[model samples]
Target: MTTRRNFLKGVGASGIAFCSCGMLDAARAQGAAPRSTPVMVKGKRIKTVDVHAHCLFHESLNLLGTEEAAKVLPPTKGVPEHFIVIEQRLKEMDAMGIDMEILSINPFWYNRERDLAAQIVKVNNEKLAELCAANPSRFGAFASLTLQVPDLAVQQLEDAVKKQGLRGAAIGASVMGQDFSDPKFHPVWAKAEELGAVLFIHPQSTPQLAQRFKGNGWLSNTIGNPLDTTIALQHLIFEGTLDRFPKLKVIAAHGGGFLPSYAARGDHACFVSPQNCNAEIQLKKKPSEYLNQLYFDAMVFTPEGLRHLAAQVGASQLMLGTDHPIPWEQHPVDHVFATDTLSDEQMAAILGGNAARLFGLKEV
Candidate 1:
């Protein structure tokens, strides 16, 4: 039996860069990792879809001109990736037992001026659409947009989904420190709901907690990332953004961050301190109940973790996610299968059924 140690060994040996974290510790593919164990449920082979894969555009890399490319780009910037992306990415997906990946580029352009950010968004959205177009069966993408300019973002979201054949939009937990609950983003949310597009929330970690997070253990990501998503989701609930756009489909990465782990506290917040929550914005549902409306990737790292998440949120809301190339949850399909608490149908849904339905992916 291949232990989790062996699974980590394969990814660590051949893992690509962590491009979004502003650092990169990438290595070339260390030969081919073994192909993944096939997922069989009820004597049928189930398709596995990885919904949290990432990538960046080479054309847009040079466009972050305010800083030197070395600092602006990931550590492995000019070294790998751009040279052999498709071939390499497909192989990794295959080894991870992923039949298709829903690609997204994190919001590095979130802080740029409107015009420059627009330029970067164009490059990324176009490239992502093109790549997915070329690899129809293996890839689909969530478009990048300039959220700082919500008007432009709405139009961009419309274009990406309607014209480009993209699945949805990828956004940061917050834009330049501005939370999504702010009314300024309502137009984008409205457009997303109208178009039936999913908004993927990927965290850049919490800049506000940088001081406390400075020591060992990559705390910025370990604690900060999940915290950021928790904060983002709370804001959306507390401020009634989710209520306003009730149909908005959201996928929160890293297992919807720390929200699922400690959600009953949210349900009790208003009861404990009515003064802390805004009186003008009344929530339609309990904060924890809103979790049922949201979707999450299974990157929680344990069968119990996934099991707990499925218990908190419905099993119907769970989807497989590998956070590919980052080496997080490399054996994703196996991970779902390992969760003994889930029935065969529940495991099938998390492995791929949920994502394939959400993204409108046709079957083999």
Candidate 2:
């Protein structure tokens, strides 16, 4: 049972704190007490794995030049620097009881020139591989791709996984303003399917919604981020990309966004307006049928939210994900453990079992 007190303890007051003021104040109030670690289950230590962790690539920043990188990245204090120190990261992981984290850099160079994008991809992949190599047991990585140039993206994926030992690739929900469902991205999808790479779809705040999201609250991240992911997943489902690449191991960040909560609407839409639904791209299954084919992270931040996600997508398809280096869900393993809805087996699987199989982790 996840009581409100337990939830607040695991995530701090920041768990329920939505606005910037609340977050900032909560950080100051919480002080520097270490978080409680994951508990032992059945006399065994649960091997916790976080599939949605992020890292900064300083080399890429240097390549892009400070001015260019600053434009794309958020103007946060000590971001890339905070994530770069290996000792600091390991200490935090140990405190949180996370045995491993699959690192990824959300695509920020998607709109850059082909050559610049390729170079950024190369540098990011190399740095990530190096980090994983240094901390083989504690860290794994997803390669960054130049999706604006699909052919280059495909080649980069192959090289990254085969040669670099990267687990998969991390991509944004969209390329510039273009959705993943666009035919131009087919080659990249096909290559990912063939390689059996885990394509992690993370969102960069949806630019189209900037005007609407601007205000005192961080609606851009609170609403815009998940909204972007929702749009991307819908396109993939309705536009036949999932049907085309059924075997692609795709993981949607932020608990598959709003899709899981309102998936039945897709089925209703198809049935109600068959003419609006493309017959050429007619899905062999209902739009919601694809939910089971995809995977989601347990970053919803509440027991009820996580329970709803599990019901929609099943426990087997849900993995522990903490948008790390960010203060969201500080104690991720504990958050999953706090959920009373999941059985001990289901809990174990979400914490690490599923990720071990998906990423081919030998340690588990």
Candidate 3:
């Protein structure tokens, strides 16, 4: 009974709140944001790793061939490709109590032709690695890959982890309009599992929903971004992509978008309306079970918001995240600390231990 008009009509006040609530929360957090580092849990200092931080190298942007159009700065929030000032970054990290940050450049070259995409990948991955090297104690990075070409993406992932010393690769929710659940991208997933590289999934705004996302609260990002991530994750789960590569290490941004918020619905969809669910692709585990193997960031805006997310995904699956330089999360450390339900040990892990174990990072 879901019609195009009905779906369009659904984007009403709730859609506006979907984007506005986070801003409201951010405004509240600004007054309480931390001013120094050395975050402690149980009276002991612990390192904090922000796995969901983003960046874009200016050199990589040069390949696009126009000064103004080169850097893809969204009107809502952005970390400029040209301005990753090390001193300023460290100062910000100190305030956030982040001991180390694993940086990544969200994929902006997926639409480029193969050759240009490869060049962009080369520049981005190499520059990120160089940054980590220069600030070994304070920085780590996820590499960039040309996922539009799976064979090349495999090589890029291998070289990035083995040679350039990147922890993993950051990817967009989809390539152009192609779903990653399609077998075409299987090689990249297989290679990532083979190399033990983490595949960080970041969502670009859902351009298809642009018509409905207009006017206000930066709905393109608030609603579109999370919706983009939600669709990508559901496809991977229901389409058997997670079953196909069970060992593949994956992480989802923005608290796995809206999926975790309503994951129980995934378990019920096939039974309630088998007609809409795919019959050809059978998932090995219950739809909700796939989430157990996946990772998520603590980008939700409030302590209760985070506490509820942890209840759904388990505290072990959650790690610190700040869509930094973009003002999305002003007090990521304090946000985690404020989760009253979490024990001291769980707090330590969420602060940084979980990320260190996943990325093999040493405590600072």
lDDT of 2 by residue, 190-215 (tens): 98888899999999878998999989
Kindly report which residue pairs in candidate 3 clash with one another: none
Every candidate's lDDT: 0.80, 0.81, 0.81
* TM-scores for every candidate against the unseen true structure: 0.88, 0.89, 0.89
TM-score, candidate number 2: 0.89
Q: What is the lDDT of candidate 1?
A: 0.80
Between candidates 1 and 2, the one scoring higher on TM-score is: 2
Candidate 3 per-residue lDDT over residues 1-364, each given as its tens digit: 2222332243342231111122445644544322356665655668889898877777888788785444575554544422588887787777666778889787888988999999999999889888999999888999998998999999999999999999999999999879999999999999998999998999998988889999978888898889989999999999999988998888999999999989998899999999998799788889988888899999999888988988898888989888776778866866776677787878888889889899998765
lDDT (C-alpha) at residue 76 in model 2: 50
RMSD of 1: 5.6
In model 2, which runs have C-alpha deviations exceeding 4 angstroms?
A: 1-39, 76-82
Q: Give the lDDT of residue 325 in candidate 3.
A: 67
Residue 252 displacement (Å), model 2: 0.4
Each prediction's RMSD to truth: 5.6, 4.7, 9.6
